[model samples]
Target: MKTALFELADQVLFQNYGKRDLALVRGEGVYLYDDQGKRYLDFTAGIAVCNLGHAHPGVTDVIERQARQLLHVSNLFLIEGQVALAEKLTQLAQRGGEAYRAMFVNTGTEANEGALKLARRYQYVNGHAEKTRVVALPNSFHGRTMGSLSVTSNPKYREGMTPLVPGFEVAETYEQAVEMLDDRTAACIVEVVQGEAGVRPVDEDLLRRLAARAKELGALLIVDEVQTGVGRTGRFFGYEHFGLSPDIITMAKGLGNGIPVGAILAKQKVADAFTPGLHGSTFGGNPFAMAVANYVVEVVRDPGFLERVRQVGEALRTVLEAHFERVTGLGLMWGFDVEDAASWRKRAAERGLLVTVCGPKRIRLVPPLILEEAHVQEFEAIVTQMSRA
Candidate 1:
């Protein structure tokens, strides 16, 4: 029993996204309700954006209050909310005694795009105008924007979009990526945990090498934390897990829970290169987005809140480890191997659970940060039944 809305959606909308047959109409806590009123335990969390969960009361209140107080204004004015959020992010980003500064955008792609510009600009201002090449690791997923796509390593993501931004190149292998960093390199970008690579954590030894080499070569070290920031990895930022203080950071996925807000954080020395007219966004830091993002940062940055996430994430990990092979990830973000992932996802949905298929054989689990130990038990039960089936 499907609705005409699903049919209409296929008819009118761009079919860029491969969608499931189930049509979710509403959500609350960790559950989604379809038009037919079947309840589903939501483990995907809207692809990791709803870090706080669905229809969160606090987030709803902020949205409503901001809607009444002020919705949007041009970036021309000084937005107190944006300033407050920037201060919070930069403070959280401070590492090894070097403070950071931040700027807002609307998505992860935009954040990375701006970070790239800042990287080249920082070098140009410092008399290294030829340092314009960016080196990216193999199997990295930054975003779909032209600039971010150029730095992204997956060849499949670039199909039908070749001749990408020149000077942007992916290293032949992960080892070669760091080896390629040099004086001519403007920046080298990486993901601490390569999410799309089946949730593989980048090799720490190589990461350390990359950081050291970037410093030695005067190339900026940029960590793409869009999918791993905002306490997703049980640390304020994923790079914190490795004790690497990156020169620039791009984040977006979980920052505002489900609201669209992204940011670029840079060491002040590098940030200074972007003068008044260097880069700008029209609706980047509107009052509405800032208000929600500020609140999300406040809640996720709490020490106690993050500790609970670590505990619960481990509990969930134990369950996945027992049943699935190659279960890996950090904090609440995890990926496991399965046979026929699409079919497995559909079967799980039939039993009232929902998950994401990151690849043909890789299933990624990015449940909300608010997920409790009891939720793990519930997930185990559903998995047990699926195994029996």
Candidate 2:
């Protein structure tokens, strides 16, 4: 019966994801249930896409209200929610909650697509069209789209998709990245916390060095905050924790708290790169996405919200480190070394815990920001058994 349903799904939809056999029916707080009512402590949190937790009342309410009132309006027409969401997001980025323009898109990949375009066009308009090389780090996962795929450094994902956008370079070290930066480089994109790269956090000194070098070479420093922004790393923006300002920032995952929305925030001067007729999207910044994003940003940017995430993250890490030899991460986004990740994942699933595996030796724990102590303890117990096994 399960195999039939899975087969039907595969036949209808293009098989990209290795869809787990379980079918999730509903979610509340930090738990998800399958069709047969088997509950699992949801530590993966939709791969860190549900920061506010599942079925959050506030986010759901906004979606419902916006759906009833007005769902989508074309970019040609001005919408209140679009303007409001942009303002809120900008305020969340700026220190005093000041004005900064935002260009919305449908997904993180789309946001990076727009950002790359903006960076290239910005340099072109300023008489540096040759500044089109993009430098990204090894083990980086930007997005699946063509432009983003070019800078993405994973060969596994890039294997068949060859002859990708030319002028893409991969840097192994900060010094190597700096060497790749020159007058011809359009932008250098880096994830604050390398989410798909085994939850690796960039060294602080490297981040500062990259920013300074990007400024020196006239290439825009594009911070891909898709997985690390909106309080995921215990800061409004992950770069805030490192004390550096990026020329451009792109985000999506948790911006809508489960709804699809992506945005690019740039410095006013650099943002001016694109003019009226230069770029746009049909469903970008529609009412539904905007309303949801507005609510998420307000809640995530609150003073106490991220502090709670940090506190819980430290506590969880302490428990996790005791079980595993190495634990790496910033906030709730953490990964630990496991002897047999596949077996551990299977055991956790059998024991009613939902998680994700990273590489062969790592287990990732990207729970919702609102996970309680009880949930943490429960997850800790499950992981401890794996350690002894």
Candidate 3:
């Protein structure tokens, strides 16, 4: 019966995504169940979107309350939830350097879109419209939207989307990035750890140099922390790992604890690039999204919450590295270089576990931060036993 339903879904749905055959009906902390009551340990955390875990009581309660009150509204009016969320995010960004402003949107891609626009607008507003070129690293994943796709370096993802938005170039090394920068370059954006590119962490020195060069070239340094932010990397933002301040920081995924939300945190001066009517979104900063995001922020912002993430992440990494060739990343955003991620994913799923693959060999492990050591041990044991087989 379940197999027939899977077949029906495969025929009906678009073939763009490589989806598994399992159909999840319900989820709880660190676990998901199919229609037949077959349970699976949810290590992927819905691809890092459900940070507080599936159906967390607090998050679900907030969502239910807010949904009943107000679901969405246009950006014309001054919404209370939007204002409160912005204030909370602004306070988070101010942890290392100055307090940066935030622009709310509806996904990681939208966040990147706003960041790209702000970069161009900054150059224009600062009397340098000719400086429109943006430099991004190779094998980086921002999102799938056209504007974000333009900066993404994976040819496989961007192949069909030809004639990509211009003024974008790929930089492999620090030297390559430096050469790409010129009078026409408006910003250099890079992910501290390339998530989809197989959990590769960029060199700290390279990031420091890139920040310095961006300053020298008078271009903004945009850090795309969409996958690594909000306590996933043991810190509020991935940039905190390197002890550097980015001029612009784009975020999503886990911001609203599964409610679609995105934001751009920028330095006050550069943030002023967009005037009131320069750009807008109808559903951006809607009341319901903001209210849910506020609750998500409140939960993740607790000091002890992130500290536990670090401790559990390290334990998971140590266990994984013992079996796999390499395991890397910070906090709960972990990945390992297994011999074959696809096969392992299938096997793990069959054994009642959920995981994700980054490449042919990279197994991404982004579980909920609230997960305990027992859950980590179960994940480790499952993958370890499968690898040996």
lDDT of candidates 1 onward, in order: 0.91, 0.85, 0.86
TM-score of 3: 0.97
Q: List the residue pairs that clash in candidate 1.
A: none
Cα distance off (Å), candidate 3, residue 15: 1.2
Report per-prediction Cα RMSD to one decimal: 1.0, 1.7, 1.4
Q: In angstroms, how far off is 137's CA in candidate 3?
A: 0.8
Clashing pairs in 3: none
Worst 10 residues of 1 by lDDT: 15-24
lDDT of 3: 0.86
Superior candidate under lDDT, 2 versus 3: 3
Model 2's TM-score against the true structure: 0.96
Off by over 4 Å in 3: none
Q: State in Å the error of residue 64, model 1.
A: 0.9
Question: Candidate 2, overall lDDT?
Answer: 0.85
TM-score of each: 0.98, 0.96, 0.97
